[model samples]
Target: AQTVTQSQPEMSVQEAETVTLSCTYDTSENNYYLFWYKQPPSRQMILVIRQEAYKQQNATENRFSVNFQKAAKSFSLKISDSQLGDTAMYFCSEAGYRNSGNTPLVFGKGTRLSVIA
Candidate 1:
């Protein structure tokens, strides 16, 4: 069994500043994908970034990026120039083995971030 942990219950970042959210997971599998999903007040889950276990380079998308530490089993999200729209509940997730589409993604409790001016 695999588990994701997000120690921060909540965080606040000023607009245009940078913020990093921490995440750690326990997994023995060699091949898998890690991700950060953001859920706003609308209750929709949006994929923020993803990192492959086999890839050494950290994943990045515009202002969003991830620090993937394979040996430490840590995957953290860094958001640059935070904006009001970045305010949301961020969840760390891992893809479990099972390509049948029946397997579920293991997620953390989530970190609620508030971007203020």
Candidate 2:
């Protein structure tokens, strides 16, 4: 079984500043995927970035980067040059491959981020 945990329930950052959201997971499966998702007021789950458990390097997408510590089972998201548009609910997820198909993602209680101007 796998579970994702986001320690911060909410956070606020000034515009153009940087913010890091911490996420940790527990899983018995060796092969799995870690993900960060951002949900805006529109209620859409957007994929911020993804990290494979086997990968040694971290994953980055534009201003969004992940600090993936495989041994520690930690995958934290760093939002650089944060913008007001970045304000949203961020969720950390874990999904393990199954013999039948891909397992449903186990999501953490989202951390609400507010990029204040």
In order, the Cα lDDT scores of the candidates are 0.93, 0.95
The residue-by-residue lDDT of candidate 2 on 25-69, one tens digit each, is 999876899999999999999999999989899999999999999
The best candidate by lDDT is 2
Clashing pairs in 1: none
Q: What is the number of backbone collisions in each predicted candidate, taken in the order shown?
A: 0, 0
- Please report how far candidate 2 places residue 78 from its true position, in Å: 0.2
For candidate 1, lDDT tens digit of each residue in 1-117? 889999999999999999999999997565789999999999999999988889999999999999999889999999999999999999999985555553478999999999998
* Candidate 1 lDDT trough over 10 residues, lowest sum: 95-104
- Which TM-score value belongs to model 2? 0.96
How far residue 22's Cα lies from its native spot in candidate 2, in Å, is 0.3
Give the TM-score of each candidate.
Answer: 0.94, 0.96
